[model samples]
Target: QLLDIARKYPDFPIVLETVRECLQDVYDVPALTELMRRVAQRRLRVVEVETATPSPFAASLLFGYVGAFMYEGDSPLAERRAAALALDTVLLSELLGRVELRELLDPAVIASTSAQLQHLTEERAARDAEAVADLLRMLGPLTEAEIAARATTDAIGGWLEGLRAAKRALPVTYAGQTWWAAVEDIGLLRDGVGAPVPVGVPAAFTESVDDPLGDLIGRYARTHGPFTTTEMAARFGLGLRVTADVLGRMAVDGRLVRGEFIDDLPGDQWCDAEVLRILRRRSLAALRAQVEPVSTAAYGRFLSSWQHVGSSDSTGIDGLAAVIGQLAGVLIPASALESLVLGQRVRDYQPSMLDELLASGEVMWSGAGQIGGSDGWVALHLAETAPLTLPAPAEIEFTDTHRAIMETLGHGGAYFFRQLTEQASESELKTALWELIWAGWITGDTFAPVRAMLSGPRRSGAPAHRQRQRPPRLSRYSVARPHSRAADPMVSGRWSALPAAEPDSTVRAHFQAELLLNRHGVLTKGAAAAEGVPGGFATLYKVLSAFEDAGRCQRGYFVESLGGAQFAAASTVDRLRSYLDGVDPQRPEYHAVVLAATDPANPYGAALAWPDRAGDADTHRPGRKAGALVALVDGRLVWFLERGGKTLLSFTSDAETQRAAAAALADLVSAGRLPSLLVERINGVAVLDPGVDAERAAVQEALTGAGFARTPRGLRLR
Candidate 1:
């Protein structure tokens, strides 16, 4: 019905009735002010007076009289009074002559006394023109006739010509133009005449006209609103044409009113279309301006408020509450309260719990219309935040070889074996097994049984025989082999020269026995049988005697013991010569060598020390052929040489090997890996033993010269 009424009477005023409680709704201030201005410019009979108050001072300044007293109470009382006096005494009297109080007192006086005000307005305009003329003359040469003529034609043109002429005759030009001079100077032009006399003036100066208070009031009311022309003219003191122009603009915007006019009064009728349109536009603009700034300010506040809330220390509900409070206080529109609270709650919990909250519709935004329980909220359910479980230890994969070995070991129990079934090389297999033991997967003692088994059974009980065994006899064919020549007549009275032919019978036998012991770990039956007989046959006894003399076999309680197969006396001597070839003479190990001699008491030979010790608990004469064995120990080089029984033999160690050994010995001393013993050289042979003081002193002096210090245990290489 309201729409139908509004459409039916578009030009009619809109009147909405509401209860007294709603009457206090204040319209937008800027909207109302713009509407009032528009209405007044339309020259309408719009009267925006203080209907509720008796005095015009109570009226809104935008719509009512702009009198001095109207602005009172806004400024100091004295200032207000001074302004009012100036307006009345100086401005009002000069602009409107002989103004009577009675003329201003009547409401109808504006309509009737408008002509008198108009005449006074013309007189005042004339006086102003005269004053402008006087001002122009003072500045330079200016004529009244020229001004009057220009005023009717092109006043600005005439004025400009006059100004140009004055400037040509004077040193300085006036900064500003007089009233009539301005018009002439701006619009006047001259025709092509004998002296270039003025032809026509521009329309701006020629068409200029005087305006009266009534005309101004009428124009103001028509253009801005429905107001009396007397009011506009009194406010602005404008001429008729200027007021009409203002009226034209207001009328175009539909802000004018039609009716009787009054002085210093607004139009009684207003253009509903223009005022409402302006009010709506201004209201929207104001609302947007106000809302945007508030939103921006609120956003800044929200950020600042919660800046410290999410730091490392804050946790749980307290942190959530702090953030929620900050958001609520800083966001726009009080309606955001629930949204902020719910959002903050959801954000505070762990991500894994989000789905539950979302499914239950525990969080939401409030702006949505017709919101159901969960309709307006955002879903926050998320995946679990816990770390994933890893695969089982048993399922871990290993190499085929490792798998095979582990499988062989069996589950839950252990077994001892000589070999492991693995694809790894021998070295790798050893390493892997060691690693397993270190890792506690296998027992360290497990190797004991396996090592024992691989090494063969231990011997027990005494043998049936009591005498030492004789070496084997060589066949006629073996005796004739050239390779055995070196062993012929083995270790006779003295070291024999190299033979030109195959070895003799005794040499062949000794060589055969050595080969048997090295390869098969057993002596020939003949050799064994020969040892059993106490007094051998001559040939058997001679062969056995030669073997024994050569240190190739020894008399044990049960049987003969073979010596190491790597060296023959000749080869040993050759190795000793090689060691000496490049050995550095300065190193202690260079002068050190090891000597092995047949034990006169035991079946096997023992390592020998020079100048044998007596009464030592660990000392024993392991060999009888002490003079036959001499060697140089040079790192991996082992050199051997033979000397006849009772002959003096020299043995030396490689210098490099001795240095390395000394350094290692020093470390051993520091680590307590070695016993307190001296490392010394006796007769050019390095000896590591607890011995005579002279030997110790000699070794200490050598070590000190080789960058070593004497320690309690031995010589230490620094």
Candidate 2:
């Protein structure tokens, strides 16, 4: 009955509006039908839960609304909002194309949408001369025929005459057409003359008599990118010159920005201020997404070659410094750093070159990890950024002797051992010096501390047989003076401590992440953890992700099995792609490069885990320790020599590969990587395990052929 009343009395606003409010806006019939269909077909389920009291949503439905958003509905702020909403209704009563850009780049779709919106704007505009004048004010510049057609009347010519005589409108020649615009907009429309004309729009007139196009046009501009006056006019079904004028007014009012927006389009264009920011952000995102993923094997081999392992591509002291920068914050033994790590990278990495960098203060070393016995492992850092890169100091036990040495050095000058001994005995001072060094407080002017730190019972690369060959000194056992021994190579360099760094954690984290990328072309949580990076990959992850957002680097699944959580500098990704594995299989030729088991480039036990021992009962497994060695044959781990350099573990069962692995160990000794290697066991068994042709005979034979002497206990390299 109410529906019948509403239909009969169309003039009664309450009845029809109530029906629309309930069925059209409040309760959507189509959605309700879809929900019912889903329930009926069992595609969705419905359940009822009885609560102790009415639920929040149920109470809302029962009371309709609890209160207004503000304290009162009649407040001044509320009154202003209500006024704005009322004005918005008239402005949006006939909206143009949707703000969402569906056909932003497609010309055909844009054109069709343009025509439909133009026709809609014309057809919906009010039908009168004052309304035409307002259109000129809002979206104007129309010929007489255009105004007449838009107004759907033949009397538009008469309206033009009235407007012209009243001096309310002016004419302008634009796009080879004389179009009339409101007199006030001449500054933005271009120079004008005496003229009057009009055309008609479609027949869907709006109820409003006082239409303001400023707010309407401003809202429309936010939906798309840069557009010219002609393009916007055609799309909106308004006068081109008038559209440009309105756009210009908005630009002057700081609501819009004018420029040559679209690169290919030839003309000045205007875009919404916020819209330009959106466009720039989207462009950066598109560019950052252009990286390609590569396989783990390829990335591993690429890293090996990139760090100059097994390759002699570096030269001079500058090259040595670059390698040190790459190795910053990486903790490795001082001994292996020169013999194995740096030597593996630079072509002719002489000790003299490193001494030069240390002497020049271009590179600095600070003890980091508590890896090697009492002295610990050290991390190399660039002299400039060393303060920023230094990790938080760890607590250490300082003795009186240590305090005396530090006090003497704290006087601000480097001191040799003999000088510091004036305050303490030589033995006491030497022990105290290393304690301070391991505490990360002191360093030597030369590399002597590194040598002294290695001077423990765990001998360096000095051949055991050569030690016995040294003839006994015939000189008297008299008190030695500090004469020519001033430049002693052992431990006589001047010792001084670096001021403790009080770093900003955030700044330090960002810097560490950048250096991490510089060290490893591709960074992964496992690899970062392997290096024992402070706070682990979790801390660096935030900075790296930020780098990606800023387009400084890329984040992607660059290596298989390393997880999708990976980040790399842009150049790193380029180099990784330039040598994809399958693209040219034989290019990075297979050479057995031996790396300290703890070297970051070893990849095994870092990016990749160690293979299971050959026998389940085997007690020892491969680990990344200071004194151990790993040999990679084309980025595949085939040998793991334990830190003691006695027990050898083989990852492969191939006889020839076994020989290759042992031969590589021999080559390591030949390259001065080790004084000698004594292999007593292979894969948890004796090298010649019991039988004439032992189970691990191949390794024994290979070691012997590589100049290893057969000692009573094992195969020893001389």
Best by lDDT: 2
Local distance difference test, per candidate? 0.31, 0.66
RMSD of each: 51.2, 22.2
lDDT by residue for model 2 over 1-718, one digit each (tens)? 3344335444423432233334544356555444334433453222345669885657876544443332233222222332332332212323732132222223333343444333334555447778878767655566766676657666777778788877777665655577786765544333222122222211222123232456546645655556777777764456777887888888778677765434466656776766654553444333233233556666767788878776666778878888888887788877688888988888788878887888888877777645646446887878888877676666688778877777787789777777775767666776676667777887766776577557654344467666546457788674577343223344667777775674677888888888878788888888888877678888999999887655677676777777889887655766776555543654545556678988888888887778676454546788888788887765678778876578877766556655666677778788776887788887777765576344366666666777889887888886
Tens-digit per-residue lDDT, 1-718, candidate 1: 2243235434534322211112343344454444434443453442333355543433555333553344334332222333332343223435864332222122332332332322223342323344445434332223344334323333444444454454321111121222223333321211100112233434553332343222323332323322444444334434545555665565454444332223444443222233323333433343333222112112212221223311444345454434332222111211112222232233344422322332333321111111222111111111121001100112233566556556666543333332456366744654454334322233221112222322344444357695457558675454454442221111111110111122254543443344323321223333233222222234344554455444544322111122222122222222222222232445333332222232111112221123333432332222233223322233221222222211222222333444443443344235332223243333333334455455334434444554555555444343
- What TM-score would you give candidate 1 relative to the actual structure? 0.15
Candidate 1 regions with alpha-carbon error over 4 angstroms: 1-611, 619-692, 712-714
Top-scoring candidate (TM-score): 2
lDDT of 2 at 34: 49
